[model samples]
Target chain A: MSDAASAPAVRAAIGDSEFDRDTALVPRGPGVHDIDLSAGWTIMNAVNGGYLLAVIGRALGQTLPHADPFTISAHYLTASRPGPAVVRTETVRTGRTLSTGQASLVQYDDDGTEVERIRVLASYGDLDALPDDVRTTAEPPAMPPLEQCVGAEDGPAPGSVSSPIADRLRLRLDPSTLGWAVGAPSGRGEMRAWFALADGRDADPLSLLLAVDALPPTAFEIGLSGWVPTVEMTVHVRRRPAPGPLRVSITTRNLAGGFLEEDAEVWDSDDRLVAQSRQLARVRLG
Target chain B: MSDAASAPAVRAAIGDSEFDRDTALVPRGPGVHDIDLSAGWTIMNAVNGGYLLAVIGRALGQTLPHADPFTISAHYLTASRPGPAVVRTETVRTGRTLSTGQASLVQYDDDGTEVERIRVLASYGDLDALPDDVRTTAEPPAMPPLEQCVGAEDGPAPGSVSSPIADRLRLRLDPSTLGWAVGAPSGRGEMRAWFALADGRDADPLSLLLAVDALPPTAFEIGLSGWVPTVEMTVHVRRRPAPGPLRVSITTRNLAGGFLEEDAEVWDSDDRLVAQSRQLARVRLG
Candidate 1:
């Protein structure tokens, strides 16, 4: 955390590291924060969806009494062009244990009028009161255990692990699923990988946002790639994370109309479901 | 439509058809609407998630310049109790082709202080500008045509179809998938059906909200039932529907912490995908 002396310098170092700096919402009037968009948080030129949602989630946490974000939903009103954006939060509903509110990322136009980029609604609560009587008939996909997976350092895989986000969040792809990325494009849309912060910070509610949206668009496996911009996304934090990498999987059974919906689930190393998200995105067409 | 001469009288005639009535937002103070929740709109005693979202979506339509709701994201902040509620809309981003805003449902507490029930972020646009160059590999689940299906009119099976929402929305379930509701348990979490308005009114964006959530909770197939309140939900409109009933399929591959996420897709009678939604819900446990 940077102090008042080097706050400007911290803001200058944009990208994955700036994510920590950008989401830092202090107690100001109406929960204010100067959003920072640094490297790897971008696909082509626009800011990544998960990165924007994470910033909004952090701000919503500071604005509400309950801090652990149980759920967050975001609508991309327009293409969120990064750089010097203003985030503002408002209380929608302050409930007993959960509080809901809306946060907006706005930037100024050449004429100096504020233009909103993205809007989000988030719910916050503490872990002490998480639901207890949990049960599931369908289990998440079984991985080959952590020891058998390959991380970014493994290098030269079927598909290139190159992106602004891959630097901050290292991904370990299950070797079996790489045929679509590097070899012949598989007709099916699916991707499974293990994700962890490069700095070794344990995954948290904020980091889970990145983990969910950080994967290459599932449409890529079906042979379509080029900046999938999210139109809307919703994330549910099922449980807090343990001290380990997150096992993540994304699947898109339907890709149509220059659009596709991707469903993602994130499980901690403990094998507990940590977060689940689904998003609608427009596939960039030639 | 009821006239101002008998607004109170109409509010008393609750159920599926009133869905259209309850969500009719007039431009009062900041696009105002006195939410009317009649019977069946409630599960057990609490209001249903889809009912609340439909009401808010209607209000959002009145509040924005682009009237079509292309996408809506709602986070249930608190259990919405029945009775008269207030819904207000505020602009988040006013874009050229699309506009985003936040709408909230609130009620007064016993002490007369206003409390929030559900908060939503909605995006509105015109259907004339819908995506054209859309392509998807996955077609909606093949149905045996409408006549071959069974509707609630067929009467009692194993599980009771008697709910507050049953009267407003009529669902035609595929017979093979009903084992969990009756006879032996299916032991899986999934549900597929065709949905239409009970009143025979053409389904609109607001009505589609009802169609998505009106299904018997997928958890019921796995031996879990009762009130399943949605925690967070996101809906994306792919295209405007043609004149016909909607074909819907819901699947839940994970359930934990008294919470399960349901993914739903709606295809219009024209066999074109109209809308897709996913929501996290808490299954009521004894």
Candidate 2:
């Protein structure tokens, strides 16, 4: 992963970045695509849910006749690992303002028996076609200037973090919310941060899919840790994001019965709501 | 719709209620089922988003080789009218703890053309097989006793309420939050009520689905009215309900740029959190 200063060069090699490279779906024929998985997307022993979903989204975007992903949702049925997988797509609906479809990623065993892992449903639409009557009173979160925000340069030692996917994205966390880094979690289940590709690629709909779930689990602030597996996640892309870093904030209302919902809002630099996402995850007992 | 005085017969007909009857998908052939639409499920010329989704969900539940629905998500592609429609489902993934599938609802035009209207992605699981480490601190909202709650018996005159769907749902609306029933709105976009099938049927996943969207749009309380069409919705079932009324509450956080989100939580009479839902909808600008 590249630091902010060398991000452009890294961006140039985005085609080689584990993220961009692994998610690159090659169209083999109609309704089908070939994919290559990488360990860089793994957290612990399982593939990162968001990373796997981005691959599915990229495949749907490439295989289907759509310009941009308006909403991409995935239900994690089982764990996926690094290696060769196939994505199969089927048209659900095609409309003037939106196109809908479904895609699945599955890994084949030694005998070529495929086991399904991720199931995704996507809606594609022209961002420009959105109604201009946008109305919301949501103000941007209180964030320190980019310079004052803390990036990976100040994070835990190289071997300390649990997720390797973190190395792929550059996160400038809102300082006040970084207490978890020091082992003093707020115990409040909330997080605010500025995120962009470590390779400096401009944010896009696919990247927003990653950004939505790439952040550390807000449950960690509630002093709960260890694999917080997402059962399902749905994202709504409301506006086209302007090129720049994205500001995101997540809040967990209640962590009840080992199941919790995390709601996040993604805002562009101009304070426009670009996307909104909510995920249901099963938390590991403390 | 019957009142509490004749609740048993109402409950008896629940298995044959309009919502239940319309969503009782009958398998006509492989990956396809016949569904009948009813005006009882409509608010205007358009069918209720939640009602349409339950039909889709039930279809998936029946067509998919799975048990209970854990996650049911749908993105509305077009407005649907009450009539004959068919649901077509395709298997996405079949796993141990979870099974995933996709289904679509479509109606034929008078010209013999088929148009897709609703697209749904569902994750199924065996609730009994879930982990027993259930622990949550979520408490039911402060609601007065059942006797003190005001049922629809006291609502606006028959011709006043905008949504006819309310007549089919027995809602004991918390009176303090009913300003919108009059010209004076609460202006806070929030509501808490005791909800049940107007026919006195016990709550189920389908009813919960309807309940999520069946309420008068919270936007109305915020001084916004007219047809507030839901763009997409995701429902997460936390647990099965115990018999009796469900205490539920919904809140809208922001109404920005022609779009808004509503989050709702349903708690069984025993105060167990049963389901949680979040929906994104286009607002009717005043």
Candidate 3:
């Protein structure tokens, strides 16, 4: 679908709803609350981590109402595996300057099976904070212009790879960092670059969360299986990247026992950290 | 109770179990071969993350059906919060030398709100691998001996920093790293260490998960209304640390708004990395 055409679908996928009221709550203590495991609930299995995060995000929204707030940056710390998890929410002091709140999701099996947990910290602030600290360790280098971008409707397309996500969005690869990005037109209200992802599928918000969760991918065609879902993801979205010839940079830090973490930045035609993100992942051979 | 007498109590507290067959099956999966969330099943809630991990460790022991095995090092990326969470498990691969499995938990509210999702990658290996490189990155400094460690019998002599954990364990703060740990005795079983955990009060295993999901007090002591739970944690137990002074090294990597992530490493007196953990915390000011 055209970027414009995809709007309704994306909104349906992410739009607000009363279905959110279906959430189950369990009291943790005097002040804390937890999700009740007895509730028959689960999101679409594809992009679970991010979808689950969206649910928590919505709850946080209830805690602190805001405007057309974007998750400029989000950090998810995994506490326990999802089943029988714990959810805690706290309102940060926004002080009339920012809209910020934090929540945690922990999973456990029995009293003994503590599998995973996640912490999500989010803020919605005024747009006035833009245009500061332009300096970065590096910037997205020059690439083919939009018309010249691979898979551009008009340009000479780069040889296609076996990717499902490729079919969903247009792609641009930066020669400098081998960083590649797949995004629809900017109308969707979010900017995303695709360089590496597991399952080789088009990543929705949920898949994006999972992709960053894995360690950075070095060579193409590497598949990972045994990665823990994202422990935390820090996302800072400046202005959405300019539409065409988008630039992306990705780097990985750790790889031990099929587990790793990597950070990525997407830039617009301008050399700014339009969106910066980090994810922790496990690396296992399929 | 004196430190010596309370040592067992602490052990019991950490080793307690509230899980039954129904809870244990939550992580199994979708079909009859797996656990069903639609059936309204849940896991135990009072156990802390560490203890829950131990239970997972135990379950894994049976899953592999191996006689002799050990976990080298496990790192938790997130923490699970209390809620109506569900779990699904898949065995990524099974091998003679190593076996890997993937588990995901999803939390929801009583009204059926989706709270969080967690994915975990766990690996088990034969103990016959080549010895690990023991070159320590940081040397172990001198500290009080085990005898000087306050036992359940000894209790804090007086005017000591009051702790909720059993008195058998006392914290030794290293000036260099500003890290402290409280541990019970050694020789318990497969794992042993001194560490500090928040009191869960009367909360169940779910609350215990939340209490430990907060940022480990390894470094900064900044105040917030409450602590955020972790999203995921991967733990590999290589060798149990000898009962003595346990040291925890905590460092905060990022904190924006109410979301934060802290990385921690637990070491025995011998300076070996017993466990490496990372927690994502959502900080909210009262």
**Candidate closest to the true structure, highest lDDT:** 2
Off by over 4 Å in 2: A1-22, A63-66, A142-150, A155-159, A162-164, A174-184, B1-22, B29-31, B63-66, B131-151, B155-164, B175-177, B284-286
Error of 2 at B218 (Å): 2.8
TM-score of each: 0.83, 0.87, 0.40
Better of 1 and 2 by TM-score: 2
Instruction: Candidate 3: list runs displaced more than 4 Å.
Output: A1-286, B1-47, B65-92, B102-121, B127-131, B134-170, B173-220, B236-244
What are the per-residue Cα lDDT tens digits for candidate 3 across B82-121?
A: 4334544444345565554444444555687754333344
lDDT of 2 by residue, B168-207 (tens): 7777777767777777887887888888777677777767
- lDDT of model 3 at position A63: 60
- Stretch of 10 with least lDDT, candidate 2 chain A: A5-14
DockQ ranking, high to low: 1, 2, 3
Separate clash counts for every candidate: 14, 6, 119
**Per-residue CA lDDT of candidate 2, range A1-286, in tens?**
3465234563534355556777888788898888888788777777877778788888877766676777778888778888898898877777676678888888988899888887788887777766676546567777887768777777562335656666667777776777777788787778888888776776777778888887778887787767788889998877778877898888887676577888888888777888888898888775
Q: What is the TM-score of chain A alone in each candidate?
A: 0.86, 0.91, 0.49
